[model samples]
Target: MTAEHGPGASDIDESRIPSWIACEDLLVKMREELIDRAIKLLNREIESGHIAVNGSTLFSSEANADVEEAMYLINNLIDDSGRLHKEYSEYIEKNNGKKLSDAEAKKFGELQKFVLSVEQLNMLMEYARVLSSWADAAGKMIEGKDTEDILRKTIDKEELRKTVLEFFINDSECRVLLSSKEIEAIKSVLGA
Candidate 1:
């Protein structure tokens, strides 16, 4: 039988779930949640015995190989996502521990850190969204069902895209986070 991921083997016990995260370290917390979600998504597929859908011999070598391949890909994607966050942190540290990057970063002046924090959070959410999309596809491949609910729970697409725009484009609190000039650099960095 394929293995179920997370605490308590046969099924995940809800008590072992991580606590409600605080906004202080939102980006870091998101990365952790994203990884947990990917694992859970894949495990659900395994438990459903939907790893291979072509009616391939459930207990055959081919079926096992298929499951292994899927697991490898998901694991790799999660690893890369974590690596991206690590690299971003290193980039910030290398820039004199200034979360806002160099003076060319933007024009928040006294509020540069706050503005940059929002930007960085947006980037992390975008990354999580991509990973969630992959998980959705994986779910489809296994259960052959709609993944709207799963995707929503893992990463809110509308919030990631639209809400961020509103926060950056209109919200007064976030208005000074980045100056007009710095936004261009952020756009380039975030590939907006």
Candidate 2:
């Protein structure tokens, strides 16, 4: 305890809560942007049809780079990832099975969420598939004397996807813990 700091010290200067990392949220945005840019490259030359999921076909627009549904699922995943990370931080607060300070606990809860259920991995995979379809279509349209320049855009898009996918794959609670088959599906779509 310090005097200038509240009761005793003349040395303590600054203290503040650390910011939480929202990698998942940013990654979702990156994914959406990649699709959007790809669509622009090809002038929105895409198709629409029913999307097949888990051995069943769901009627939804198959293309045009509209990734609203994908975004919804990704946002849920971001929340879930935040909650999971907070859970670990909270767990670490317990020393030898003894509960820590109420302030710490409260902060953890505030930083986290009660709804812990994550977005379905299959749905995320489907989103990746849709993105890949758009990418493939857009890739074919790269032309003109600026072909090399446009191809760079494609490279950047894929790189962003890779970065996002790696984020999920590196987190055990997010996507790394997924089944091998499901992981393969994501990789195929991401061209990883």
Candidate 3:
């Protein structure tokens, strides 16, 4: 007896499925959020006098080296993340209007995970940069009284602090993570 062939026997042709633009959009949003968070963290460190004041060092020489190593890792992550993003964009452009299989969607989801990892890495790097800057400033402040004068003249620390905080809180990307009420609270604290 011969079995009858049906629709199940024929492979479904889905070469017309449009790629999800939302994935790329979300990745972009995530990157913006990461950058904003970094800036906010940096501002917080500065405002707390962690970076601007002369005091006992937080990280010793060995610890400082370790911290730098961590920063290097984060920088690498950012570079790799950027490359992945470029690849994703290229794939989307090349396959525009083309239907992706379920397997492809799953792969895209995995790629998104990598994107998030990079976002986290960026935040870490930003934190490291803030700490490094603070350490340098503090060292200068310790060097001599003239160093303090130089720092004061070079950047109106107070003014710049306020401005940076304002920019972070008012940023369009930041507005989503922070509510209007929260933003107001931050502004009040920053004296913006």
Q: Name the top lDDT candidate.
A: 3
Model 3 scores a TM of: 0.36
* 1-192 per-residue lDDT for model 1 (tens digits): 122122211221213522112111222333345444445555555564433234433434675675555446464444564554465556555655456655546432423343343344445445566544444433433322222222233433444533443334343433343334323422442346
What's the best-to-worst order under lDDT?
3, 1, 2
How would you encode candidate 3's per-residue C-alpha lDDT over 119-170 as one tens digit per residue? 6556545544443343344343432223223233323455543443455466
Off by over 4 Å in 2: 1-77, 92-153, 162-192
Give TM-scores for every candidate, taking all chains together and pairing residue i with residue i.
0.23, 0.24, 0.36
lDDT, candidates in the order shown: 0.40, 0.39, 0.44
- Model 1 segments beyond 4 Å from truth? 1-24, 52-71, 75-192
Between 2 and 3, whose lDDT is larger?
A: 3
Candidate 1: how many backbone clashes? 0
So what's the TM-score on candidate 2? 0.24
**Residue-by-residue lDDT tens digits, candidate 2, 1-192:** 322122211221112311111112223433454444333322221121111123323436668224554444344445565666566556545533456488866644543322222223423444455445434543454341232222233445555445555655554444423344334434554557
- What are the RMSD figures for all models against the true structure? 20.7, 22.6, 24.2
